[model samples]
Target: MSVETVGIIGIAALFALMAFRTPVAFAMLLVGFFGTWILGGFRSSGAVLITETYGAVSNYSLVVVPMFILLGNIASAAGFSRSLYDAAYAWVGGFRGGLASASVIGCAAFSAVSGSSVATAVTIGKVALPEMKRLGYSASLSTGSIAAGGTLGFLIPPSTGFALYAVLTEESIGRLFMAGILPGILMMGLFMAAISIVTWLDPKAGPHGDHVRFLQKLKLLGKAAPLLAVMVLSIGGIYVGAFTPVEASGIGAALVILIALAMRALTLSAFYEALLDTVKTTAMLFTIVIGANVLNPFLAMTHIPETLGTALTTLGLGPYGSLAVIILAYVALGMFLDGLSMLVVTIPIVFPIIKAAGFDPIWFGVVAVIVIEMGMITPPVGLNVFVVKGVAEDVPMSAIFRGVMPFLMAMIIGLLLIIAFPQIALLIPNSMFG
Candidate 1:
């Protein structure tokens, strides 16, 4: 049988595994190992597995994943996430839909540390949902805001999405992290604007929050300052070349733990739990990396990516047209696949087309991350939506999906603007790197 035909079957088997609720890492591993054996015999498959496993686990760059995740887990245990939400609420809660807006802002801040969309959604949703419910906010608006806002975790600096993308594409993680800053801020603004539009259309949806005295606002901001400062120094340090991504992650994790202890917000048991959670999360991500590495070699042997790229070029679509098709494909994939899975499965096939078309790789990274973030809220597999549902238990799942619709539109708009003027993503990375 032809190699390409075998590759197609492997792809189908991978999906079948996923449909059965198999973990993504194992699914990829199973498909790649058996498929490689089919094409190259047992010895080659064994070597691929052993070598890829060691490479993924021992890669020094992966250390950032554990450190950044620990930083976030510890921050949550320390109650710093609450301080961020309170500070945001103190400033914006008086406006219509202000509480919801604050939720988005708080998610962005926490995302700077956490870099995991589900974590951002859960942490902020737990804090903001109760307050919005108590204050008579509409369930759709309140729940939708947290769900949409959590997507920022995948876009902001220290993002595991970017980290994994960098590892797969061999692009600069620091550059990708830098590239995301402006777009992340822009997305947060768009989410807030969507809240304002919702509240304006139906004032009953979101009542104005109580006015806070300036002194009280200042007090809450002070309480949030420690984590806020950590975010700035870590990200800013990257921009100025003060440290490598790994260094920033390590330092940031250390700073957060120290600050949490200083505030007496973290008990020893909580600290231990954070460490355990970090280890588990890190192990899961590493397994995915190893699986991708194994599968990638099998894919190359089958010539699927080369064949697909050639077919795309044959379509007579200009670069922009080809890009639109790719973007649409990503949207379709996002509905089913998680961001990391999409990145790992598709980048080898797609990145070459994007590069051959003369598009900037770093800009494409931002665009890809944004599209994956969109998937986090899109239906069927809207991971963030389900997370928000877990927190706001009484709210129907349908309400949360309906609420995220406007923010999803905002994402489309933001994505178009970035595509039109690539500089929005490129400006910071260019200025800093050049």
Candidate 2:
């Protein structure tokens, strides 16, 4: 068989393995190794494998992954996520559908700390769901809000999604983090607006809870202040050039650990567990990254990216039109693939197309993340929906899907706004970096 044909078959086999529930790391590794062997001799393939594996894992920038994950895990162990939710609840829990709105804000805040959509959904769902239920909020709205809000983990600064994207594309992680800030806040606002509209149309779905006095609100704010400070010092420090992404992540993790110890919120066992969790998550991320690195060289040998980019360019679709198609494919794939898997699998193929079409890689990163966020709430494999379902056992799966639809619409609108104004994603990064 021809070398290009081997690459084609390898791509097909990769998808088949994934469809059968093989892990992405394993699938990519297997396909990439053998495909390279088919084209080049065993010696070349083996050398490529060793080189990519070592290079991927040994990358200094990858240290940010574990540090940020540790920061998130420590924050969770310290009960900072709960404090974030409580503070948001105190301020916004009195408005019509206010609890739901607060859930969105809480998710956004915790996402800055947690950086994983599943962690954000699970943490905030545990805190927010019961209260919404107690307040007689509908299961759909309560669960839907939490599930949708969890997506913020992908879009907010310190986000694992963006970190992985940066590593894959060789973009500056700090710039990508800065790029995410405004878009994240804009999407959070759109989510709140969705809640308001839902409650305005059906007040029974989101009845107001007990109002907090001004002093109590201040107290709640104080409780959440440490996390806010950590977020500011880490993410904000990066923006102002005080720290690189890695330093910010290290300092953030250390600061959160100190704060947790100070508050007596984290037991020794809990701290140990947080460290273990960080190690495990970091290991998983790096394995997939290594696998992707192996596959990338194999794909390059086949000229698949060049071929596809030429094919798409030949189609006469304008830049925006071509982008729409790529995004639509992301949305479709998101139904079955997790965000990280989707990103790693497709970026090698689509990134060349994106650049050929004249889109900024940073802007495209934000756009890709938003589409991936949509998938987190999409059906069949909406990971966040499943996380929220585990927390809200009483809420039916279908009902959770139903609840997520409106917020899904909100996500779509936020995406459209960003597309119409690329500056929404670029303003902070450009101003700071330039």
Candidate 3:
């Protein structure tokens, strides 16, 4: 069989396994091992796998993954999420559809600390869902907002997605983080706008409440100051070259723990749980990453990406046409795969095509992350939707999915905005790192 044919078969088998509910890491590993064995002799394939595994795990840049995850886990357990929610609620809860708006704002703030989308969803969902329900907000609006808003976790700094993308594509993590800020802010604004339009069209979707005094709001903001400061210092420190990503994570983690201790929110039990969760999450991410290391090289050996790039170039589609097709492919895949798995599986193939198309790697990373974020809230296997469902069990799954539709539309608009004006993502990175 041709190398291209083998590559196609390998991809088909991977998807079949995934459809059968095989773990993504294992699915990739299995396909990679067998595919490499077919392409090269088993002895050679085995040696290559071992070498790739070691290289992936031992790389210094990959260290940022665990450190960032640890920082997020610590912040999650340290009551930082609660403070963030309270601050947003106090400021916005009096406006029409204010509770839903608060959830979006709160999720953005929480994103500053927690880089995992599902973690952000569950943390904010648990804290905000019940209150929104009690205030008579529709289930769709409440659950949908949290699910969609949770995607910001990766769009902001300290993003695990950004970290992983940096390691994979050899981009600067600091610049990638900085590049995300404007796009992230724009996305948050889009969500807020969606909430406003929804509530305005149908007032019952969100009801206003008694306003908090200015002093009261000020007090609530004070509660969130520690989190705000940590975010600014960690993100700012990285941008200004004051610290590396790993060092910034360490500082952020330490500050979060101190804040927890100061608030009396950290007990021995909570601390232990934070450590345990971090270990678990980190182990899972690394497992998939290592598997991708083996699979990516195997895929490369097939010459599929190069072949596709050549074909596209011949077809006269140029860069933008090829990019549109790639984005569409992501949207279709997003329906089935989680964002991380989708990225790990496809980026090795798609990224070279993107680079060959004359796109900047860092700029592509931001756009790719946004596409993955859309998948997180999209249906069938939307991780964020399931997370909100876990929190608001009484609400129908369909309603939650329905609620996220507008935000999903907003995300689509956001993606177009980023694509149309690459500078929206590139400006910060260029200014800061140039």
What is the lDDT of every predicted structure here? 0.93, 0.93, 0.89
lDDT of 3 by residue, 106-208 (tens): 9898888778898888898899998998899999999999999999997888788988898777888889989989999999999999999999999999999
Runs off by more than 4 Å, candidate 3: none
TM-score of each: 0.99, 0.99, 0.98
> lDDT tens string, model 1, 1-434?
99999999999998899889898899999999999999999999999999988988888888889999999999999999999999999999999999999999999999999999999999999999999999999999999999999999999989999999888888899999999999999999999989999999999999999899999999999999999999999999999999999999999999999889887899999999999999999989999999898898888889888787788889989899889999999999999988888888889778888898889999999999999999999989999998998999999999999999999999999999999999999999999999
| Steric collisions counted per model | 0, 0, 0
Worst 10 residues of 2 by lDDT: 1-10
The window of 10 residues in a row where model 1 has the poorest summed lDDT is: 304-313
Candidates sorted by lDDT, best first: 1, 2, 3
RMSD of each: 0.9, 0.8, 1.1
Worst 10 residues of 3 by lDDT: 61-70
Under the 3 Å rule for N, CA and C atoms, how many clashes does model 2 have?
A: 0
Prediction 1 global C-alpha lDDT? 0.93
Over 1-434, each residue of candidate 2 has an lDDT whose tens digit, in order, gives 76678878999999999999999999999999998888887998899999999999999988888998899889888889888989999999999999999999999998887788888898889899999999999989999999999999999988999988998899989889999999999999999999999988899999998899999999999999999999999998999999899999999999999999988999999999999999999999999999999999899999988888888888888899889889999999999999999999999999999998999999999999999999999999999999998999988999999999999999999999999999999999999998
Model 2: per-residue Cα lDDT at residue 47 = 94
